[model samples]
Target: MSVLPDPGASRAVLVGTSQYEHLEQLPAVSNNVQALADLLRGPLSLQLPDRHVTAVENPVAAHAVLGELRRAATEASDTLIVYFAGHGLVDAQDQLVLALPHTEFGRIETGLPYDWVRQVLLLDSRAERHVVILDCCYSGLALGRMSAGTGLADQAAVEGSFLLAAAAETRTALAPVGETYTAFTGALLEALRQGIPSGPALVDLGTLYRHLRLTMEARGHPVPQARDRNSAARVALGRNHANLPAWPVAAAAVADAPAGPDERPWPDPRAIRTVTGFLTALADVRVVSGLTQKAVSGRSAGSMTAGTVGRLLNRPDLPATWGTTAVYLSACGVPDEQITHWQAAWQRLRTQSAPAEAARPAATRDGGSGKPRVWQRPMSTFRRRRDH
Candidate 1:
């Protein structure tokens, strides 16, 4: 668990443009902004006040978005975050611009310039740390035009800033229609909601970026790119305030059990409705058994690695095979009867999840629906590029 400096204040500017005049309308953009805002305000998360968050939706001009960014940068004394979810374009001169509602195709002046946003963030002396999250095509270009003379290492030495972009310079970011969020934002929200594995009271930018990258790649989406300039990687983005007790009474009881075979008071397996709930219960069982992930891995005789155990406990989905589950249970010293209960729970969850998984859209070139609506223009050129 990383300890963060006591940032005096935190502020955020959330911008999302779903309704565009000359470009394709991304319906998921609105949901992306809302979800990020909710997570920032969550009790066990950032805990920012309503006044600290400024949300701009479907702005007609570049100034509308830039004005909010300027305000946040000037007002925030410690931490500032700017998030944009919309269309992005690279001009003939290779400048990246964020598209607004009234932005026209190839009209670089009409869109918000990424350089101007970066300048505002860099010039803000009030904020000690700055974080920029972009979920749009060509967003990686935000850092492309940054001071050319300064290398990434040099930039990191001076400014505490970070950039989280959805794709590389030539790649397109995707926002699947009908989904609550874009692939990148969905992974981000999940990371914040779940917190880091093991015992971490803080969620750092580095951990979040790694999670986003892995999640997007696993789902066959574009690999997200992260640039850490300064100490932003170590700076805490959110607090993990989950109400997990340090020591459970059940754990003490299990520890004091007779030497031959221990009896543990586990929760009713039938009550677990989701894969996360099942993994959490399993984690609790491990805590009661007083075994670390390494210890459990050792108990499995290297059948399962600590990394595998961590993923099994943290991932939203269950492990791929029943054998993995059995090995994990055996490592945790789970009795045969309890293992049977867990197996039943896993079967029920699998039965319920099959239809839901089948209903999801497959990973396509556009990463969205097959057909475009009458008002929407097809992003034929901006196809999704999945990582191998």
Candidate 2:
């Protein structure tokens, strides 16, 4: 694990606007800001004191927001995070602006210019690391004016900065009715709280972004976007409460057991009652082996990519080819002797789903459509017959 910055040296500015002078009010904005603030101050390793956190609610003037940002820029020496939950608009020039309580639709000058916020937080801030999270429509436009020279390799040239937007430049950010936070912010909070599975003890920007993007997209919500220029991918955002070691030492001991079939007690494939049950067992084995989907893919010599492994694990129905299942089990360090048991289980499942002709009733075999009596044999019986 990489060393984390001093939590005490970090500062945060949370701005939320639920009441607008002209636009419709968003009741969830306040809840969004409060939930984020609580996370940062509570579980997040950023032991940011209440004094270091500047929270602005329904600021009528753009200067007030800028003033809080300027203070954070001057005060923070290690890390700074600025979060906004409200409305976002694009001016005629395609520049993004934050909508304050008094911001009008046509008057861009009245809104807080995202460029100014970026400049102050990324360029002018004394902090070593900077993070900007926007939960509003057109938030992706926040990166529209970033310096073209700001490439991932130019980490030294540009301070480590990460920008996360709730939606695309053209899409509207959604707030599910009656929910406390918008879809994006809610997902963000959930990811942060749950942490990445089989990842490091500390969650970073890259991991958080990936989780956010996948989760929101899966829920049919607007896709979020991230712009990272300061090698911010590795910077720790918070401690992962859900972090688990890749592999337990005891598991390696189990793997060292003799591979001989005579000495090994293979589990009965018939014990698996349902596809979901089999998948749950497979997932448990993977976790115990301490290998991530990416690591499992690499161990498989690239035959199975990380995405493929994820899909296989997520879906209750096994892959079409038993070869894929075998590859995954082997990669997860399942004993070769035990793998055959899994393969047998997989074959049984496939046979159960095979064409009706394979095991059609006597009446059906004779082409008599007499509502062919359904064969309701237990899996154990089938296993017994196959053994014979």
Candidate 3:
């Protein structure tokens, strides 16, 4: 199970604007901010100290919010969390801006540019991990910018950072009438309070995101979108209260439970010698994990990406680096022991391919140097090792 952040070393900032001078007011935004602060500080969740959690209500200027974030960023050595609940505006360039209490619709200069938040988290912060949650319309753009276009490799995303948005790129967040909080934040509060049943011992951000996505989809609301770059996916925000002691066994026991329909205990790595066989084995690990490519990438801790995972899995070729395979397996919940075995196998294949490539004719090696020579295990050996 994932451990909670140390209260002493972690800092959180919650900013909300419930009242706007010229635009529509969101009274629920204030509620959202307060409730979340309580959860983060209370025993139910992270249980952080009151001094560590800062809640700014109805800030009149952008600097007020940024100042809080900057302070927390410097003070925190473990984790830093920044949350915003208010109207989200776009600048002339369609960049995200957090609307303040005095900001007007047409006059976006009065609002706080989302980049201020991003830059501080990306460049200014000293914390080991970051979690930024935005509650507003068109917030998915923030997540989109966190990564370059998905590709096989060279995805330079920030490590140990996770961003969750209340709405997708094109949709607007909802604040239902008579509700104490906005739709997005209300569901979040519910998840933190009630917990997910039969979930892991602690409620991780990835698991929490999954629950929110399902809840929003069922309610016909704008489903929240998330981007997790590294170890942030495993950060446990709170204990799973709904997962009671009715099953008093260890957390490891749950993981060792019978496989779901999508999972299988695949063949051993020692039997895989060819690129196709290695790829096939990797795909099997993914099936056992039952996580989406995006989810797997989200937890890879800067190793592989969703596009990279998809590209490598679907292709007949092997990965460009061991980092790709290692992260994929780690993110998919494969044991470190198994991963070490797989790594040896992958290295053995690479070693074999180098010699074969050198020996191959120029035409066979794809212009003599560009393509990797595919590895193949003898048919007799493969037959002897076939799974039952």
Candidate 4:
């Protein structure tokens, strides 16, 4: 038997935004998030390691949640999981839109696009297992659509990383009867709790999709459908490497503090200089990495330039809320493992930084490292490897 390595490197970010004071607000969104947390931290907890879980509530810390998730992907972890419970919309072109906490007046200006999230997930180079379970309206966008536009029921298997959206783009994902669980989340919980038994089944992508549909229908709810469940059409971890300098340590000696109410605090003035210095280092890394052959190829026929990706990493402009990052990263294609890596790094740095001078006010910048950092790699000499 081929023994798979321990998934200790794996990490999950659960973003559940339930309260929306706006007209687009859906109360069940929060319920779905809480239920998902219970599922992961409860019965599914046994399947995952103890240290691999981080659950964020409401919209306050969504961006921080996403930054952490991005960091996790960069850590070269083997598995990354992201679960989101909220309202999902689509653009005029039928693309997906993940709504945030303060999304208001049905305006597209306040939403996060699906394409952004996809970019985030594609950042991880070492993840062998990636799963995104999004229980939102028209979430099928999370799973790339079939280019052929063939309506025939198709299936995809999960090898390294895969996504499971709550509903297909054409369908409206529904909420469950009790405990604010969405139909998709409810079915997923059932499958995780009783679906995966002590058996020899591989629990491949097809099986998981089938299980999800069967379990949902069995419970008398709308049947769950999956897009790009076929192994032929999944996300591939690319083989791009950069010769960038080592990551700088002690940026403002920043420390990651617990997510609490009114937690607005500033970094140490001393650490600010360090953060500025690291930002300079990151800028150089991006320039050199960009000069190299930075190419990204995925299972889907789409490819992105390393320079474009480097911009996503370095650009720090964000909404002034917690869940915005999670929503944005989910939209960006940033993987969950990478986010966890950053969270770990943030925590470590936070420990070395000064204490909270005041409540962390709502700001686009987290007052730490403003630049997105990445390793440098060339696009040349990047051949698809059948085995690592």
Candidate 5:
């Protein structure tokens, strides 16, 4: 019994600092912020508009940190989510402070106060729900009792607010030595992408919190803490992917296959049946390899220029020759064996279309009296180029 957020109305500001001046650098924090942003925008996940999500990473100044939060808070009318994954400091007054790239431990003033983040939402935001996720040391300090100067456990909490902290008041969050994301954010992403089994169709904050806590505890990681007020925990975060229908066997195999050691996800070429399909798959391989047009040209030793790569990807017709296609794939780091698969697919598609192409008319040179019967070289622009 939950609903997805209105994609146009919700706003999210993801902030994380991976580099530090006085404290140890957290390289995984940047990954956390980026991966979360991708999950929030991906069509398979939260389905939020790309523009509605903002990511601020490794800020050197507090202004940049507060500026994005203030903007997102002011704009959001449905749900406002502020996520911070970096160092959390407790000042002399025991207030939660978010560390920046240039933050110094002795000079806590250089960091942004968690209270300022709350005030921005409380005072400026018209959002119906406010969700704050903090993944840092002593982040739970932002949600404890407000006993004199024992640190305001979220002083003046918003009417409908949910604050999730990665660690308890005296604990430190952990970033595993070889992980891409910090422990807390990593688990959070997993829940969003993997979904909760035996859960409802839509995943609300309450379910997500349960999954996070249990999963982390089972893995011997820090168990997160949550302070939900006025049923803010009921707000749906995203659809439960686990409850979605399963993919077909063929599709599942392709989707689940791991990338090669080079991090290239060379697609299976057996599925391609048309010029468009073949080229589209080839373009996808280039994208997966993280190769730019210029990079491809350079990698291919200038056999394929950047301009040629750009045009080739956009063009619907097949390349002028097999050599062109092979060069492009080789530039994208496709193995010779895989390149052979692509070559076979390319030939099959061309041959399949050849009969229809052979009957097509050409320019009126002999008053169109004769069709490809007069001249035949596959009767395609791709073939015409080579003939000329």
Candidate 6:
């Protein structure tokens, strides 16, 4: 007798919305949603079984679209519903709203909350598997105001649903500004494209999270997060699992992994000297994030150039002529709030310094303080001094 595959296996719905009436209002967000949808239908298609994917694009009918999701959830064997890319807003009651086209304004007003999705997944106890991936901002807005540690149900009820939201309540979910992609959805695509499948061969969720954080940092964006009952899921990996995509991190990009007690070697004294000089000069220079005129002058401090500093701080590398004002503010330490404060401080310093910089007369005089005000001076001489 032939062995039958597991009875209930797979089905999915992918929803993407790009066009919005108020293009000026939320163009970036809409565009990102569309891009993520394209990826889901194309390169990421391998994950799901053929033809099991249903995509609804730019639907004018919100109720009908949601009804379809409901139908898919109820009718499919093992279902995964992915809503990739959209801007979400919370109502006065803090309920999350998934936007539809203009016609369904009334329904949107009383739209389904995120918990509704969770409840749908949890209700069917007989279903072997369910996954909901929501890639939108203010995602937690609909999930209720309960703190992170709060139980899924406010009344301490247990639910089997596994949820993966793109970001925490505090972090702003970013839309692709230009070439960039939405941090949340972008990370998801990268994970699906490159994550490891451990057991019988499903893509490993833990590894995906690890890659997501690392990729976001490299792309000059805040990392999206993941929360779920993964350990309890005990998802089995099937054989001949998907392979990771090729992503290159330049040799210079690697930061030595944090040292363990036994493995830790003393950092090179020269690097320490370089870091000290850079920090001292960096403290004096100010760099603002959105400001147009605030330029970062890449001068030499330690081994890193001013350009390197600008890139490190996510600032533009201005000419060395910008003087001390060009120092990009990227404080290196723990406590992220402190880093943000320093970043703001740098901007203010840059603003204060810009005028004084213009006021300074052009060079007609000799040896007036060889210091360029910014630390762009070459480190060759400094190296010599350190050697001595």
TM-score of each prediction: 0.57, 0.57, 0.59, 0.48, 0.59, 0.46
Question: At residue 265, what lDDT does model 4 achieve?
Answer: 16
Instruction: Evaluate model 6: give its TM-score.
Output: 0.46
Per-residue alpha-carbon lDDT of candidate 1 for residues 1-388, written as tens digits (9 for 90 to 100): 2323222256889999888777777777898898888877654455566777888999878788888888888887767888988877766766667778887767788898777877787775477778888777653233111111112222222256777777543333356556777767877887777665653445678877887777777886777767887667766666443423344234234345577754443434554555645665565556545667776777787798989888877765666568888888877778888788889988988888778767764442233455433234335522322221
List the candidate 6 regions with Cα displacement exceeding 4 Å. 1-8, 22-50, 103-112, 124-126, 139-158, 168-173, 195-202, 218-220, 230-388
**Candidate-wise lDDT, in order:** 0.67, 0.68, 0.72, 0.45, 0.72, 0.41
Q: Per-residue lDDT of 1-388 in model 6, one digit per residue for the tens?
A: 1011121234456665455453223344454554544544442322333354567666665555666566666655533444644545454555555554342233444344555555555674334455555555443232211112222223211244334555444344345445355566666655555444441123334445555667766875555555545341333211112432122222222223254332211111121112222232232223112111212222223434555554543432223333333233321211234344444544544565567667765431232664433343468865665486
lDDT string for model 4 (87-123, tens) is: 6655566565566766543465666655555566765
Q: How far is candidate 1 from the true structure (C-alpha RMSD, Å)?
A: 19.9
**lDDT, residue 129, model 1:** 78
Which 10 successive residues of model 2 have the least lDDT summed? 143-152
Worst window of 10 by summed lDDT in candidate 1? 143-152
RMSD vs true structure, all candidates: 19.9, 20.5, 19.3, 22.4, 15.9, 22.9
Over 4 Å off, model 3: 139-159, 169-173, 246-388
Candidate with top TM-score is 5
TM match of model 4 to true structure: 0.48
Q: For each candidate, how many residue pairs have backbone atoms clashing (under 3 Å)?
A: 1, 1, 0, 73, 1, 10
- lDDT at position 193, candidate 1: 78
Task: Summarize candidate 5's per-residue lDDT along 16-109 as a digit string, tens digits.
Answer: 9888777767788889998889988774455566888999999878889788888888887778888988877777776778878887775877
